[model samples]
Each structure stands twice: as structure tokens, then as C-alpha cells.
Target: MTMMDALGLIENRSYLSSIVAADTALKAANVTLIDLEIIRGGYVTVKLIGDVGAVKAAVEAAKDAAESFGALISAHVIPRMHEETAKLIEKQKGRPAASPEGAKPTAKQEKEETGEQAKTEAVQEESPSPAATERNEENGQEKLTREQLEKLTVVKLRQLVRERKAMESATQINTAKKAELIHSLLEKMEKKE
Candidate 1:
């Protein structure tokens, strides 16, 4: 290969290839006619533009003072390239500085957050509990479904019984009595197991 092939690389502006050539020559000291970059003004220039070590070795080789035995022969060196630079940036919009600083959240804070999450979940149009839809005030009555009745917990049943017993309104006792009987049956079943 002639010096023209090496010079042709400059036309394409291949910065990477020059670094590769420098690394190859520096490491293995591979010397060939193709490795020499013949300049226009009669001096053969070998270019090594990379890290500091690469530039040093390339300069020595180009000056024929490399002392690399016959393995590194002929050329002048020009250093012009540098390695790629690296940078990193981070951005946070909502993160707190220390998150209350090594204190770890209290149990109450955890419970409150859980309770808030539950309230949000409940508000998302999930299946309603009977307590969720209280009796219509104007009518004073609501038709509770069997499924709702079946799903009531013992505490809920006790609360309902207490509410029924405390009713000052005279007209609702018959329905309340029926509810009490069902509640008694539920209590018995719960106790039996």
C-alpha cells in the first residue's frame, strides 16, 4: 500500500481509525510501508492522536528515536486527537432530601398511609357495602340484598343490633326484630364453630 491510501483516510475524517492505528503500532510495534503517512512536503508523518501514552509513543516513532529495534522504523509523528469525554446528570422533581433522616417511618405513619390508600381504593367505584349506602332519609327504608346480609361481619352485626335497639322511631320495630332474629342465628353459627 502507498502513502496515498493512508492519506485518503484523512479525507473521510475517520478519527477512530487513527487511534486504532496508533494503538496497534504502540502495542505490537508493527512496522510496514502502509503504516507511514507520506506528507505533501516530502516528510513521512505517522499520526497518533489518542491518550497521553499513545501520543508519546507516536511522537517517538515519528522522530525515528523510538528505540523499538527494527520493529518500529521510519516517520514523523503528529498528535491531534483525544478520547471521548463522558458526563452524567441527574434530576429529581419530588424526592425528599433525607426522608425524615434515618428515623424510618413510625408504625402510625405506615398505618395512616395504608388507611389513605384504602380510602382511595374504596372511592374508585368498587362494590358498595350496605353501610356505604345508608337508608334514604326521606323514605326511612332500604331493601338490603341477601348477599349484603351474608357478607356482614360479627362486629357489623353487633353494631346493627345496637342501632336497632336504640331506635326511638316506633314504626321500624317489626323489620328490626326480623334482623335481630337473623343476627342471633348468625351469632349462634359463629359460636358453634
Candidate 2:
């Protein structure tokens, strides 16, 4: 085997439950990993290959493995095939997006392409999107996104729950295919307060 073949990834998972969840998640994606190394510090890096779908799933599964184990795991999505930006560009058809209608190609012409692909071309021009923050700021009355709920430093989650004057539903989460996001938010409040 070449030197490239010898390098491997290491990961550590949290608990038995997480391990099961992580393993199941990985297996569903058809990634073949040896030396699952489920110990607190064991890691199994599956070499990256296969179609975009399978590779992406394997990477995600490995990440879930770390999250499940509650391990300080670091998984890097190395662009084994080529430079990352190039790989991303390849995701888009090779030719650059056509310029907007009647727009002349000037120094600003390249910058004017506000379509999705242009934004990906260079990261320097990007601005932080406010959609998520705006969604989180609605009088604290609007439903919280998973991330917003996650960020509330426990105490804040409690205050928000008490402030929730209306109850949405209970049976929605427990006996359903999905967990109650709102209920989880309320739980945060109760746990903190």
C-alpha cells in the first residue's frame, strides 16, 4: 500500500446508545469500515470513494458516530479527489452560469452574478445571512429552530417557555414519528427554571 493508503481517521464515541444509533446510521449508507474502534478514543476512518451520495452518507455517519459517543471527535471532509473549491465547482455544470440578460461583462459583471453558483465561487464576497437570526427574534413568540433552541443557555430556554402563553400540542411528539420541537423547547425552560 502507498503512504496515502496508510493514513486513517480516528474517532471516539460517547455511549452505548449513541454507538448503536451511529452504527445503524452508518450501515444504512453501505460504508465498509473496519476497526470500528468503539472505545472512548478508538477511530475508524473509511477511505473515501464511491458516488457522491454514498460518500456523503458515509461522512455523515462517521460524524454521527462521534456525536453518539459524546467523544471529542474531529472528522474532516478532505477532498480526496481534488481541491475542495474545484469539487464544489464540479457540482455545478462546468460552464459558469450565463450572465444576467443584457448585462455587459465588466469588472462588475462577474460580481453581478448573484445566482447561487457565483456566491460559491469566492467566499470573500459573502455576507452572513440574517434569515435564521430574524426567525429566532420574533418577540420570542415564533417557534424556535433546532439551532436557536440549542443555543439558549438553559436559563433563557426556561424564560421563553413560561412566556409561551399558548400550548400547541402534546400528543404530537411522544406518539408520533417526530419529536415535539416545541415540547423540547418547553422542556428546556422547565429544566432551567
Candidate 3:
């Protein structure tokens, strides 16, 4: 019978804890680090692959290490992962290890290094420039009507807020819905008036 490779996973609420777990797992067995997914809202998942015995050992060690940090969410080992499951995992593999010196650049990196910058610039030029807000600034305050503010995209609205010196609320601006962004912009405009 052909032996199948195994997959192990460890999840933690803290990135630091997840890193520690991954390190411990690597040290504990002959497993390979597959990826480290940084989920939204601060959760992180460490993925490892190897023989069943090695993967199980690695996951156990990782779980113990992560639990010591009081941030361990869960840990699991699949003795023989299905091909479809492996494909799904492959699709989510975003955290490839850093390349050693003298390694060739990836296709994506090469494209970015060549034509991506010019393409991005062309697209930006074609869009309505938000530079109008900067030109309308009066005494460090932006003058934008509700209609004008509503017409602007969320990205432009965030930029306007930052230019108006609302640094403390930058995080809120990033996660806010479009309606919230519009409301906040109006409120900031009123405060300046």
C-alpha cells in the first residue's frame, strides 16, 4: 500500500503565538512548513505537511507551545489528506517562505517589476483625480459638499480624512462602510467649519 502524506494545522489568536508554534513544530519532527495564514481580526493558522507520524508529532508539539501563550485556538492532524482537500489548501497558500540569495524571481514578481507600475499609473490617471480635494483646502481644512463627498470613493474619502489630520481614527476609516465614511466626512467637515 502506498503511504499518503499528512497535513497538520495549528490555529492561534495571536500572531506571535502562532509563530512560536510553527517554530516548535519544525523542531519537533521532519515536517515541512506549508503556509501561515493571517486571518482577519488577528487570528493565524500554521500549516505543515509530512508523513503521518511526523505530522502528528509536530502538531502536538505546536499545540503545547501555543497553549503556553494562552492563545491556542485549535490543532488537528489529517493522516491521509484527500486530493481535493490538498488542492483547496494549495489555493490558499499565500505565505511562501522567503527565497535564498541568487534565486530567480517569480513570474508575478517579474511582471510587477516590468509592466505593472506603468499599468497602475495609467489606470490612476484615467480615474477622476482626488487632487481636487487638496486644491480646495482652505486653512488646513477641506471644503467638500455632501454631494461631492458622496461621489468620492471610500479610498478617496480616507485620504481626505488623513489629509485633514484625523490620524487617531485611521483604523476606523479603513473598516468603515461607505455610508459610515460619508457620515464621518460630513462630521469632520462640520467640526472644521
Candidate 4:
């Protein structure tokens, strides 16, 4: 696998711990910061991409730093991530950060600041709401088809599973593959029927 093919992930219970982890990871190796996502319940996840050895080293360092705060949840290194998984990470990078204090710029705001309002409008038109993508009217009942489930991103599928409380832990949802997420959601849907 190429140097850029590997992916590293580190999740922590607090934003401060995650920031420290990200900082340590960057200083420890030549990895690129993919994104730092602040999930629900104040949990934070830092993603990195680089050579297999570099990513592994970075994650190890990050894990140690995050653990010092007693906030470390999990850390993993994918030596060669699948193309689809890489695409999902890229898609997530395009999304606006959830903070409302203008700490992070939204895509539209970034475009507008750069005098690209037209492009921003185009992006808004192209991206549909999560609800629209996940559900459809089936005999007047709101249901997600298997095809739709497959079309949904892994992150979205994990959110669906979490919302249903089907999984007992966030780590399970985070570590599950796309197919596993789909299967779990499908099983939950069936149980609801």
C-alpha cells in the first residue's frame, strides 16, 4: 500500500484530550490531520492519514498522550483503508463543523468569504438532507429500503444505530464495518415491525 493509504483514528472522552492527542500525533510523525470530530456526549475523535508505519507510530503516541488525561477511548490504525472508506472520510471533511460560535467556518461561509457565493449555492443544491436520503414513503409508511441503507454512509448508519439504542456502546458503532452497520440497522428495523 502507498504511504497515503493508511488511516489512523483516536477517540477520547473530552475535546481537550483529543486536541492533545492530535498535537502529539502531528509532532511524533509526518501524518496529515484528516479531521477532528466532536461527537455527541462531548466525545471527540481525531483522524490522521499517512504511511503505515508513521500512522501506527502517531496513533501510539496519541494514545499515550490521551491516556494521560484518562480520556482515551480507543485508537486504531488501518494500514490500507478501502477506497470507499476513504471516500467517506473525504465526504465528512466537506461537512461544516457543528460548533455554532463561528469557531469553524461552514462551507457556505467559506465560499462566501472567498467571493464564491454561486458555488456555495450549487453545493447546497447538490446535498440533500439526511432524512430524505434515509427514508421513503412505502405504502404511506416511512421506511428505509435495503438499497437506501446501502447508499447511506457508514457514519450515518452508525448514527441511525445509535439513535435506536440498538448498540450498547459507542465503540461498537465506531468499529463496525459498513455491512455490519447495515445488518444491525436492518435487524433493528425488523424487530420494530
Candidate 5:
């Protein structure tokens, strides 16, 4: 069999969880980390290559270990990957890998580190351009986008929740949920206005 005949893939929401999974897989069986893909929304997929049996064992070990750290999106072993699959993997390798979720800089952090030029850049990054704005308007008053909501600090989200008298609901939710709820509330408030 060719070297790329057997493969395993594991996906997780947390980078730390992925690392744990990769580590466990290597220790559990004779496998090597072949590729890693970071998809949007903080999802990461780790690929491993080895003999079919080894790949299966590694994937099982990784699945169990990764689940404990965070959400385990998926885990699977492919005994024989198709030619197209190999080409796709090669294509992905050509592109630079994305930074882990936690390592990414926030708009405020960028602004603080850099000066007015950076502050302007941060705002530009958050704001949709004139063309996008026109398109959004044409679509009949688009609500706050997810990217915009993510840019807001947790404190800002909590404050917005309190303002809308949703403190009771927001109190139990995590920071991400708080940001989403606040964004929804602000949209509703705008509609009312």
C-alpha cells in the first residue's frame, strides 16, 4: 500500500482540544500528523496518517481524549483515500495556516497596540464597506452582523443586556451567547425605533 493509503481525521472546536487529540493519537498508535485545517468559527480538523489499524486506534484514542477538553466535531478513519482527496490535501498545504481562535487579535487589542492608524484600521475591519452597506440596505435594513457582534467586548454585551432588561436571561449564558443575545436585542430595539 502507498504511504497515504490510511488516514484519520479529528475535528474539534477548541485548539487546545485538537492539540490534546493529536498528542493522544500519536501516543496511542504509530501515526504521524499529516495535516491540520482550521475552518471558520473556531473549528479545527487534524489529519493523521499511518497503517489502517494504527489510524483507527489513534482516532479512537483522540476522540475520547478530545471530547473531554471541548466539543468533538468528528473523528473518522479512511482506509484508502481517493486521488482527489490527496489533491485537496496538497492544495490546503499550499495555503498558510490560520491562527488559532484564542491567538487572534481583537479589534480593541489591535487599536491599543497600534496608534490612530491602527484604530482606524480596526474600525475599517469591523465595518462593512460602502458597497456592502449599499447591498445590505437594498436587502431591507440588515440586522447587526455576527462579525460586528463578536467585536464587542463581553462587558459591552452585558451592559446592552441590562439595558434591554434581559439580565435574568443573560446571567446564565456564556460570553458568546451574551454577545448574540445582545445583538438580537439591539436589532429589535432598532426595529422598534
Candidate 6:
């Protein structure tokens, strides 16, 4: 397998802009599309892997194309990624090994299995858990609120606060107060969406 010497990334606020970036990147060079991850708040990040030269060229083309559609959030190229980074990327893509050793199934078979697992996991996560419903039930856990922010942990709350920069005043408050501020901010964000 050829080692990918570089990884290019282009993030855009709009999904359509991200698609345009991905198309431009693929057409501009002999690179592999790593993934198009949908981040919070309708943002998307397009990733590509290839030789350094190819990745650089593809990223430039993608940036230009993506900017035409909407605000280009960010763009960068990793000239040489760490092994852990490669492993993480593979995990995210759920790609089977390039070579199936021993009695292992072929790459196509592995991919099909992985794809099915991903779909199943996605469906389960997207649906509200039974515990999160039936508010009258004396389950210790609170029901899932309409904002859905209550289900998230404090760490996730901080991450969202940084992402949206929606509540500047919340940063100075206590943890519980911070969470309240974040919830209100997130509600405003959803309304805008």
C-alpha cells in the first residue's frame, strides 16, 4: 500500500459547500476521499489523503471551489500524519485492511460488514432512548428535552460553548449556571437554523 504522505482538510459551514469541496478535491488530483464529517451546527469537514504534492493541489482547488458556495471555515494540510492519526482515520472510515491475510474475508466483504455495523449504530444513536421519554416514570434520569442539550455531559457542553461562541457571559459563571447559559444559547442557535 502506498503511504499517504499528506492529508488535506477543508471545513465549510454549509453541507452543499462541503460537497463542492469534495468534488473539486477528487477531480483535481489522484487523492483518496477520507471522509466528509458533519460537525455541529451544520458544519462539514472534507478530508483527502494522498502524496504531499497531490494533497496540496487538491486542497487549493477545494478551497477555491468551496469558497464560491459559502463561508470556507478552515483549510489545512498535514504533510506527514502520525501513525495514530492514520489509525483514527481508518477507524472513522471503517475501511478493511488493504490485504486480507490468512483465511480472512476479502476487502469487499469486510467493507460490507463494517458498513452494516455503522448503519445500525447510527440508527440506534439517532433515535431517542426509551428512558429519555415517559417523563412521569420515576426513572432517576430526566427526560430528553426538546433542546436535547440536557442529555450531553459537561465536557460536551463546554465543547459546544467553544464551537458556537454563543454565550460569552457563561464562561465566568459556575458549572450549573454555565450549563443553563449554554442551553439558552443553543436554543437560539437552533432557532436560527
Which structure among the candidates has the greatest TM-score? 4
List, residue by residue over 1-193, the lDDT tens digit for candidate 2.
1111111233444445345544654575654333334443444333333344554666666666566557635654433344443333333434443333586765543554565456565442332234553333424535445565554444444444446632345443333222344455645544433
Q: List model 1 lDDT by residue over 124-187, tens digit each.
A: 5333455755554554534344455555544454455455443333344334555654455445
For model 6, state the Cα shift of residue 43 in Å.
0.5
**Model 3 worst lDDT run, 10 consecutive residues:** 91-100
Prediction 5 global C-alpha lDDT: 0.72
- Model 4 quality (TM-score): 0.50
Against the true structure, what is each candidate's TM-score? 0.22, 0.27, 0.49, 0.50, 0.46, 0.49
lDDT of 3 at 46: 97
**Candidate 1: worst 10 consecutive residues by lDDT?**
82-91
lDDT of each: 0.40, 0.44, 0.79, 0.81, 0.72, 0.74
Weakest lDDT window of 10 consecutive positions for candidate 5: 133-142
Summarize candidate 5's per-residue lDDT along 1-193 as a digit string, tens digits. Answer: 2435687999999888998899999999999898777889989999998888999999999999998986799999888766566556654676323323467765754654577677778767755454543223433543454565566656655655565554455545344475567666566556544
| Winning candidate number (lDDT) | 4
lDDT of 4 by residue, 1-193 (tens): 2324699999999999999999999999999998999999989999999989999999999999999999999999988877567767766886433332446776765774576667676656543446764443433334566787776667777887897766889899999999988888778777666
lDDT of 3 by residue, 78-143 (tens): 888776666567657632223345889788657655686798776565344556554334575556
- After superposition, which runs of candidate 1 have C-alpha atoms over 4 Å from their true positions? 1-98, 101-139, 166-193
lDDT of 1 at 15: 28
Q: Indicate the residue-level lDDT of 9 in model 4.
A: 98
The predicted structure with the larger TM-score, 3 or 4, is: 4
In model 5, the number of clashes is: 0
Error of 3 at 4 (Å): 1.1
Alpha-carbon deviation at 187 in model 4, angstroms: 67
